[model samples]
Target: MVGLVLEDWASPSRATASGGEYGVLMYCAKIASRAGHTQRIFVAEFRPDSDTQFVSVGIKHVRFWTLAGRALLSKKGVLSSIEEARMQTMLSVAFGANNLTFTGTISGDVCVWKEHVLVRIVAKAHTGPVFTMYTTLRDGLIVTGGKERPSKEGGALKLWDQELKRCRAFRLETGQVIDCVRSVCRGKGKILVGTRNAEIIEVGEKNAACNILVNGHMDGPIWGVGAHPTRDVFLSAAEDGTVRLWDIPEKKMLNKVNLGHPARTVSYSPEGDMVAIGMKNGEFIILLVTSLKIWGKKRDRRSAIHDIRFSPDSRYLAVGSSENAVDFYDLTLGPALNRINCCRDVPSFVMQMDFSADSCFVQLSTGAYKRLVYEVPSGKQVTEQAVIDRITWATWTSVLGDEVVGIWSRNADKADVTCACVSHSGLNIVTGDDFGMVKLFDFPCPEKFAKHKRFLGHSAHLTNIRFTSGDRYVISAGGDDRSLFVWRCIHAPH
Candidate 1:
């Protein structure tokens, strides 16, 4: 969950950063910085029953280590001088019965090693590169995931007996696309596989069919996310050009549709029947929530649409663009947009906006550090304290406000705190920041340097965050990681 850039040789061990990675426990409190690829260390494990014996596998290198007191002894794995075997890169390793260590290679072969010496190489263990291997600790079986030949369909989760003979395999294709398995382990008598597409699927021992237990966005910067006005489901749109609908407790992806455009912002209509999607191409479209049919479409500007909101009364739609304009559309005039006046004279691009409870006004926060209020139909800026103070917002999502002034640190940049959402009960406000932190603070926190609770489980910055209908859970979307996290509400008594 690191937000900072990756550095080489930072720790003497020069361990590979964990994005192109997974982690496991090792025997040594101190690591032996052995030579391998400069960027990645794939897997490390302690040999069965011996604290002194350890194994590590990575690109083009596999090493067995012997720890004696403070002195760590490492022996580079030996492979036969076969011209092709010399080029094989080890990606996964697991221990077998009687201390035999099996390392999966880039050429789909499993090299069996007994005490640092290469014993035998099992050919065609997989079609493509074997990315992961798990020993069914209870049974003397090895599970490997990779591609299968002939058909070339990837994501082959196969089980091999003690003799390394193939027993069975399952290719878990998700929605017409083969999902490559990233890691594998056994759980509760079933096989649990974590896929490269960010899905946790469980396979039945007897049935080859796999059930997806969890799923998420796959590509960078998932900026568009909005909860259903009254239901437990939520929608997320991403740079991958996908709009996925997911449920709360089930954590299952209910449905998804790709509109062929990278969506930047999304909002559910107040009545819950329509969804408004703002895209990277500056076009915003409305879709019928249930059928996902295009209800309306518009490309009012050429720049990206930064934000979109539907009035609480469901009569108007507001679209804020990177061009520093907020355009209004009358929803009451049917599918065709009745172009109302546009709000201008703002200093910078509109980053966020919300309508008043009565739908007469909208408050927008811009990139240039301005939070301005504008009358809805007239599109006139309002400055009078008496008028602005009396407005009740339908939603509070702006990051720049008197209430959220504490969210910014004295040294924080404008992009540091990207998104914010207040709770339904108005008890607290949660924020997503560039450093991948989710912070909780008192609502309307005007005090300078306000105290807050920080939660870190996302990589890079969070693009968007929203509390579900009851404020029972918080959904946070990642920027570089393409991960969506759901956090439960744990508020302290005021």
Candidate 2:
């Protein structure tokens, strides 16, 4: 771990923290700004094994600064303001409806938010911390699942109806608490559940009533599970240090790969032609589905790879590691070619990372909680230095543009951070935070929309954020309020 504790800064300063995302070790340097803003710079290290020496991965000394402040956008170097809020502990986001959802604990209850507005939807939802939530393909229905029950017993899963504002469907009696939950289109009607006991259960609707049960090896908890988009096939990873491929319809294990390290996260390439796995021991491997051959000789690094994604064009694989840098490899060339270290003067862990649909740029969340952009091909910083903290998660908006949009920190006139999102198109943005305040930002010109204005309200800290498909709504989840909120994006007018 490589981070610094800021003892001499302002009231709300930053602390640098570092760890392995899977196997890589990233170092972050965090610093505070005049307006109580924070920035981070990330450096990455990679290696083949414990005995071998570490390689630089070609990402040393590069710097990234905040793009949200006045210094970066001064008349000499002008940009735009898109929204409000400083930072968020965002939880979950879903596609299709152009929605983003967040989850967090507030007074022991679960809260949800949409578009910076409080949804007025409330529920006791869980006895303990709510771990994950999902929105189904069916309109207006959401699913939330948690592991620890109120009684400290087996956990439960609940289904809710957004329009009706009630608990519509739920399963309360699974013997073991759920380790992970996945929602995928399996034929006409089945939901797949993976439990802590290394078992897979398929819950189907009446029309597709085929309750499939699958059994597999290693007594450890399951780490991750995912299903194919067009097919019913699914894949699972476990702490027992194994990855299993299952065919849902047959309810049988298709193949197994014994990765040397305990698997942390797994992802299928967008084309479904390959699978990428991040391990606990600071290594990442790419495997061909057909031959199951491990690709590129088992690339090992010093830090863990927390997030793995294939670019939209499927030509490059972007990896977000415990180190502050984001690395990319050409699918055709088979090794990392480019890397983005933490911002200049800002050294911190990368809390989250995402690539735009066109793969031209990347979004980064620093350990200090600040968010910024890096032009892809050139690996250049887009914004000025700004500060944020405790940034848990972030995702790219689905709207089309050469520009990137997502939630970020909004300090306004204070030193605290709030949650906000920016739209590169309208140059407009919105934000909300722990104070339950939501604001809209408009620029003097559509080209300069990165500024601020308070617009809505919430009762607690902002947990998750995402924009709707129509670009007209933003969804947020998880707060002290224990409710879901959806805000309609009001155009500022031409």
Candidate 3:
């Protein structure tokens, strides 16, 4: 695992020139594997006498692949294959009534897994990258919208049956990129499609023709579109920093409100009584559904809001930001916006977050490498040593001395560990490395680790690593390989 070290010192020479003291902060990060390699070093000087200015004198170097001079680990896994494209646009996880979790990758594949084991993979569901996916309420049919490939004719809106087989495809004439697709209601036979050119096209399930096309936004591209749960009303937000509500059947604008910042995302509460708008300027506002008035507003100057979601009970709102902070607000209390708790100081930006079915916990994932779980009301961390327990088998050499350490120091060179996860019991840990390998390690291993096993399936950088709820298996995903691997935990305690 990579380590960060920081130190501060007083620069006597610089102090003498300015007739005052100045501090120099030194940050050193080392990626020590079986092979000796230096990754990055950063140094900053702070001068408080003038304007408290900070100047940096360091270059960042990142190694995405393994270094040379090391023996490769043996391949290990029950299943391995290429399943999707190189680039992915989105990912959605849905649960069935039977407790089965289905993951749909925007690379145009819908995969069904049972406890980290791949049960099925629906290949080539769309001709190109899928932008949005939704399941209908009647027969659980999946609706997908995406841009067509260059070889293809135009963009498509497709519907899949219960078994994930393509049932119908709708041909669109606009030929614009579909940014968001949503179903108006259960068994309504009407689907709403938002395009990058700020147009909202309503299409019917039985026919391939557009029912209505409305210019949703005038200034900028539409970022989000949401439908009301019980009414024919829908909401759209755009880069113009405005949120507008429209009536579908009436084909007219119902209300409009400007948020004074670029509106990046919007969502309506499941109860249909409130709406949340996330802005790009680190501000978010809550509006009343009936009166369309601002209920509350808050801001985080560190980063912009990326996504917003409400708990299953519609009582708590989870606001994820680019600064790795997740704030939970209690909606039961009035316009004061009582902040129940917050999960802050994470390692990376919070790309997506979801509340548990019971609304007791929230699960969040970052852009590159971190997955965290925290209790809702108490804001207590549920993941035990997730970041520090990651163990990489590599040969790490000391810069000033001849000391060498790591799990594979005796046999192999070095590997770059990308992501990691610890089991709920805190007895085991799983790590994904740049060589597309997933390895399991015994927690609290000796300095020269001896107990470890490898799971090899991906042929690219392993971007994600996760453990099943029961810690029975490990789920991993590759970065450019576009493949999802499910490995059975052979050493899981029985």
Candidate 4:
């Protein structure tokens, strides 16, 4: 909340509404950006106060902050004439030799500055935007990561000497997507590189081989996730056009199948033989879990499939879509048959659902905050209160269920709670919301504003969450942060 409110992060116009008015505070002082596009602090470094006190960099702006008595003050960095001609928003800042400051720019250039004035620019220091840099005197050089020379190749890495003039560049092993580097770190006799797609790589010194230490969805939001029926494996489908299987114990991505079309939802069968993936193009495909090959594919309509679920008995497949309908496929005869039925008549698009423990009924939560009940296979709406109450659900994901009515805070909007999941033992619940919070609540939280503990990590919206197979941990995905987090669960927390 450092920058002035704007229409959006990329906009220059100020917003009419402010976030808060210093609630729960007696007195406070703050400073905000006065002019230019919205700026988000990328990095803040602490150093002995000199002509350059504290340095921070962000979108299109750099500010040198200093302590004036008890008051904090910041001055904007001034670009030189030539520097202004090829201006780049600073991406990273680091302290160099002789009280000088160096900043990496979006244009792949490095700017050497004295105090608040730009001194020089080393052009094309990197092929694309320089994301992160680490300075180490042990190596007597600054290590940087950015876009690779060719977009298809991996990111560009550089080791710059003290003078900031000459450097050595390293090429990462090529991958399908452009490896835009997001982080760099000094390791034991090596360098660690983190990419935008969540791949963690290790490179040995000078012309040596690079090893991929970790892997994930190369890019895009990951909304689809499924836990293996009885193992430590997790299935994740991302808009990166790949559905990846990850080993939860070893933190290694095991196997992946590229769907060409971006995938949005995924579900592993209760029998653990195959998985169903829903794509952004409204198509749904079934793939063998072991080999990662397409078992079957179909599309009932051409709209993004928001969610897909397999019944606990492994007899039914339900695909929820943005077209305001739920497509049902009878899998008892094997998934290659005609559609059993399509459930409709919801006021809004389908958002989430759960099948009864017996697979005879389903509970649906629509985008409009409506919770409705439907009979499975027949696709017929179920309105009898007695029947709906007696049904035992294998899962509890719909946000609007009566048993979980206490999850909603007073005056909370309908769309605030994006996702919720129940632990296997049915003793606890995990939920994600628009505020990027993952909260834990007691099962069947029926009291208004039920007591809960919130953990914050992701940015923007946390769109999905689920408990691991053993109920030992929970996995959550951020819609905007593009990050998947795993949290260990505590059995008892009063």
Best by lDDT: 1
Alpha-carbon runs more than 4 Å astray in model 3: 1-213, 246-253, 384-494
The per-prediction tally of clashing pairs is 0, 91, 7, 1
Q: TM-score of every model? A: 0.84, 0.36, 0.35, 0.81
- Ranked candidates (lDDT, high to low): 1, 4, 3, 2
Candidate 1 off by > 4 Å: 1-39, 81-84, 148-155, 173-175, 187-189, 249-251, 338-340, 384-386, 490-494
lDDT score, candidate 1: 0.80
Scored by CA lDDT, what does every candidate get?
0.80, 0.45, 0.54, 0.77
- Candidate 3, after superposition: displacement of residue 363 in Å? 1.6
For candidate 3, list the clashing residue pairs, or say none.
Answer: 33-394, 33-395, 34-394, 34-395, 34-413, 35-413, 70-413
For candidate 1, write residues 63-151 as lDDT tens digits.
88888877777888887654455636889888887778888988889988877778788897887788888885568788888655534
Cα lDDT, model 2, residue 452: 46
Error of 4 at 227 (Å): 1.2
Off by over 4 Å in 2: 1-212, 216-229, 246-254, 297-300, 335-346, 384-494
lDDT of 4 by residue, 220-250 (tens): 7888888887887778888899888877667
Candidate 2 lDDT over residue span 1-494, tens digit each: 01111121111112221121122357986432332122332211111122221111011111112334233211111112323321222222221233323232321134433433333324455554344455554564555555444343323445556542545334533453354433222333555555444445666544323343644544443444434434656566666688877653353667778886777556677678888887766677888888988764334457766556666677766666666666667676654433433233335555445666567666666665555676554556766434112221223321212232222233433223333444434445444555655545442123323444443334456433434443444444324542223444555445
- For model 4, the superposed segments whose C-alpha errors exceed 4 Å read 1-90, 113-121, 137-139, 151-155, 165-167, 174-179, 213-220, 332-337, 453-456, 492-494
Instruction: Point out the higher-scoring one by lDDT: 1 or 4.
Output: 1
Worst 10 residues of 4 by lDDT: 1-10
